[model samples]
Target: MAATVVQLTESKKQIQHTHQVFDTQKQAFRNNPMPSLLERKENLNRLKRALLANKDRLVDAIDRDFTCRSKDESLIAEIMPSIQGINYTLKHLSGWMKPSKRHVSILFQPASNKVSYQPKGVVGVIVPWNYPLYLAVGPLVASLAAGNRTMIKMSEFTPHTSALFKEIIDSIFAEDLVSVITGEADVAADFSERPFDHLLFTGSTSVGKLVMSAAARNLTPVTLELGGKSPAIISPDVPMADAAERIAFGKAFNAGQTCVAPDYVLCPTDRIQAFVDDFRARFTEMYPGLKDNNDYTAIINERQYERLQSYLEDALAKGAELIELNTANENMKDSTRKLPLTLVLNTTPDMKVMQDEIFGPILPVVGYNSLDEAIHYINDRARPLALYFFGYDKDQQQHVVNNTHSGGMCINDSLMHVAQDDLPFGGVGDSGMGHYHGKEGFLTFSHHRAIFAKQKFNSGKLVYAPYGKAVHKLVYKLFIR
Candidate 1:
């Protein structure tokens, strides 16, 4: 399939369509309202059933796009996690939606304070291709639960999967409530220009900036889920084999296409060989048949595949040692767009591979003599979306966690930290900004209105009438700080 490009242009017809969709949905949302807790629970249950029923189709579509999406990986990584999020939201929505009570000061004893949670009218979600199903539904669940209507724009790179997803969602919900828009980049660019109460985008940092700029025209609040070069630090205390296994699984999952996937690993010089050996063994054991393996995903498109190829070639030319966990045999090469699960060693800061986010199955193993060096190396770059530390020591873990800031952290593991529905998922600085999932997701689409209710009272009126000297002292004592 050829890449479809769409350039957004200003036209009366286009603007009218955008406004019509927005206003229609906004009205539906305002009148029908978000479901009651029972309704939400029922809808979630329905969604879970739909996923269960369409699991094979969904997996197949992802495989078609990636060339190798593992069934178990898809179930665990996308389907189950989404179901878990839905269950979490269903279980907690009532409490999350309830009005919060606030304290009234002695001077305002006659008044009561409270906060009401109101939904943001419309939400726009721009999803990425790497993990299309999970990213699309994750934010959709949050937006729906928060009583907001959603318009989801799927990535153009994976058009097949995007079309399939649109079909699935269109079958499930009314277009006015939860609609899917599938087109080229121009459609997305135009969609981003539409007026929305809140916008959540998950993609590259460059695209995130464009989304933000487009959204700014309408003063729409946005949550940018952009990617950065996330680092995984292997501590000396942890067994090299065990650390490698965890890190390898994360980096290899979805062909290391995850936004939070470990882009590079920081390990002590001595343990590099041990880590490499363990990773190789695990990669073979995990997917015994590489070529026809439906478990590993392909790079989303030819451009990305070529981009990764370029990075590998550049790293090799720059004198970085490339070790593949699984080599492309005749069977593998003929049937799949299988990329070698590789580790690059002796990578210097000057190298091109080290300069950007790999976003592929290439893992650069940078050696450091000490933990301080590792920490310093990671801190010097733009803070990532996630910081992964694998160690058992309490103090060392705390030191790393406290001294560095990322969108989130995983101690002794990678990527799994994001599965915790209780934790807020987001990024910091260049990694991205704003948070969602669980209560944070609810709050992300909610407006908290502070309310102060008062009854007719006599004591507060002293300063309002006659301007007396004694009343000034009392008023000053009550309010002046």
Candidate 2:
């Protein structure tokens, strides 16, 4: 009972701290409503230097958090993207900040119109655990570029990385400009309820709904990067080797904990076995052995491990066939939460693996008779965050592109669309809403305020306070048609 009381006391303290930091940021943003271009560039450069200086420490922290996360995977998936995203933003920020001139109609003489992008005050970023560094820094880069004060709420599931990240952020930024808050789920709920000017959340769909609901109380605009069953399709004529290799890399990277990972594959009915064989071969080549292998990453935690295991068990009990890709046949009963890349065949709509976002190294291959059938199958479900189609035919590619609805697409590839610095990243419908990355990221955190300038001329007044004036009739006659 005493321990419970102490825990509650600590929670209260954390909540109070979060509120204090938020208020400080709000006031700071009020003081410096818009940062100069050079100041924004300097902030980006400072973030880049900090990331490069502590790259190894960040990798090690993530590894400790996940127990068996590969160092290369962390470097590739988390650190590299964060640094690269900053570079991309720094290169394009000046152009993005310039006021956009709009055309004035002939009816409005001696008038000039343009749009000025202004920062939306304090922004709240709720980072997910899968790729904590990249998710936190990705939104932070955009928010800072737009001259907004930011407060990030890191995931409790990745405690080590979260704490280390908070330390790093504190070293470089004052709490009023950028702050990192770390705590458990209740703390996250409290943080979400704060009245941030804009909030960006990266997590599951269910949690996203709750975050949106909380933000609604303050009428805070949100950019939710949620996840669903992102699908990959294998064209009938495409070579199985090519499709399987790319899909293998997509699903195997970071143990398929990526939001944009290929959740399932839709292959020609005749090539189901062939695609499975090739996928298994390619995955094994990537990691010859799962046990004692440094390249293959393990599941994040025990709870996630059991969740994936239960998915397999439930699928099997419901008459689904399981093909374990344990090439070395190593015993995995030990403490390492490593799970082999398993393939579930004969998946149905009711199975857990088919129904939920399989955020692990579990790939379910569903066979379709024709290309139309595959497209229809995807259309029937909630639109995914990403859709991958493998085929060289231009007509077939365009056909799929025109018919399908998703946040992003990759023709003849998978997962690479997200790495491109020029493309916008987001989802559609049940998958998610709002776009970020590239120009979209800057616009998402900015309010495009339109400005009209008229000097020595009051043309609008000619039609004012008069029902049937000659100038008003002329104005209507000239433009009404």
Candidate 3:
């Protein structure tokens, strides 16, 4: 934590510098392949200090990058989870790094079995624009704690925040230990193609495929944190007022840019209107002014803004009822990409709003006659990253938890599961492939090598190659049988 942090300038040699940093880190890891516990703790400590020191700076940078990212949202979503991840890793490193003992059979009585957790040389992390700092630092927390070197690739869309990230990282780590690569598509492609020991990607499902392909050439293992159409199911037993507010909070936070944000709601056919009314009321209570409120976050860029607008337009044209949740009733058609929350009802399965992952503050309420039908509706689509069930009945909640399959699920809640360090945060199947939080993250970046050690009394010599007649038959009869 006391090391002098390097001051970095933007590199003009995008691809070349990437290769150079990779080689440099590989050599550094080779020089000290197994960093001591003290060394690893110090690395984590430095990151903690860096995050605490630059808390405000990171908030400002993201606000500039996005038209107006809410300060509280940045603090809660980006900074808070990041600091928690670091703290959780530091708390449990002692036991997690210890070699675990395993059972050995009587035939191997003279020997003992144990699995050692070793570092995976260098790790490559590709950060997406949506949650740049959290994605980068979350993996960094795991990689460094597991005693591996790391290199990060920032998204091109958020150049300002990416550059600021590069600056902050330079202050804490040498490029050889942790380097940040910032450039357009070409640089990102080259960065992913590097032969790192382990690679982790947090982005869309399509780009995850490309990264996995690139990692395949070198036989490098990858952990992809991709996104899908995550859904929320409200049981008929629950009150619409409570269910709607929780769903509204999750959708409105970050303007629904979160990967695990509830994509759509499945309500009892009789209560669909009530759910819509409750959601609108809660949203209005939260943000009284839509256009000028600083607490309300804006979309990241013009392209994303237009994409959301198109979805709204398409839904309206396809006979879907549109209700804009603009509590203030102000005109938000200005240049600022702050979109008011909108609800689309009577949406068909064919509409783009229902087909795509809505990464905006638009919620589509799909009505279902039976709870089984709602679960079936979700299962019919691609597996989602997260699922939520809002109901007071314990048996119904348990049934939902048992029947549905997703990366993670919350009973009567949305978006809180990801914040828990004790629980792993990741996706399943199409949503994502691996996990990275707490011990799971540590294990993902580590290689558990099995070792069997024997004493001077070598009992296994009884079955040596010279004993192919009597001893071999006895061994087969004893152990193999």
Instruction: Report the poorest 10 consecutive residues by lDDT, candidate 1.
Output: 1-10
Q: Which candidate gets the maximum lDDT versus the true structure?
A: 2
lDDT of 2 by residue, 1-481 (tens): 9988887888899899999999889889999999999999999999999999999999999999988889998888899889999999999999999999999987787799999999999999999999999999999999999999999999999999999999999999999999999888999999999999999999999999999999999999988899999999999999999999999999999899999999999999999999989998998899999889878888999899999999999999999999999988899879489998899999988999999999998999999999999999999999999999999999999999999999999998889999888899998887788989978999999999999899987887887875788887888898889
Off by over 4 Å in 3: 1-12, 466-468
Best by TM-score: 2
TM-score of 1: 0.93
lDDT of 1 at 422: 94
Candidates ranked by TM-score: 2, 3, 1
Local distance difference test, each candidate: 0.84, 0.93, 0.90
lDDT at position 458, candidate 3: 92
State model 2's lDDT: 0.93
Of the two candidates 1 and 3, the one with more favorable lDDT, higher being better, is: 3
List, residue by residue over 397-443, the lDDT tens digit for candidate 1: 99998789899999988999899999999999998989999899989
Write one digit per residue (lDDT tens) for candidate 3, span 1-481.
2221211223337888898899999999999999988899999999999899999999999989987889999999899999989888888999999999999999888789999999999999999998878888999999999999999999998888899889988989988898888987778888889998999999899999999999999999999999999899999879889999999999999999999999999999999889988988898999999787889989999999999999999999999999999866798887499988899999997899998889999989999998889988988888999999999999888888888899999888899999999898889999989898999999999999999999799988777787668989988998775
**Comparing 2 and 3 on TM-score, the stronger one:** 2
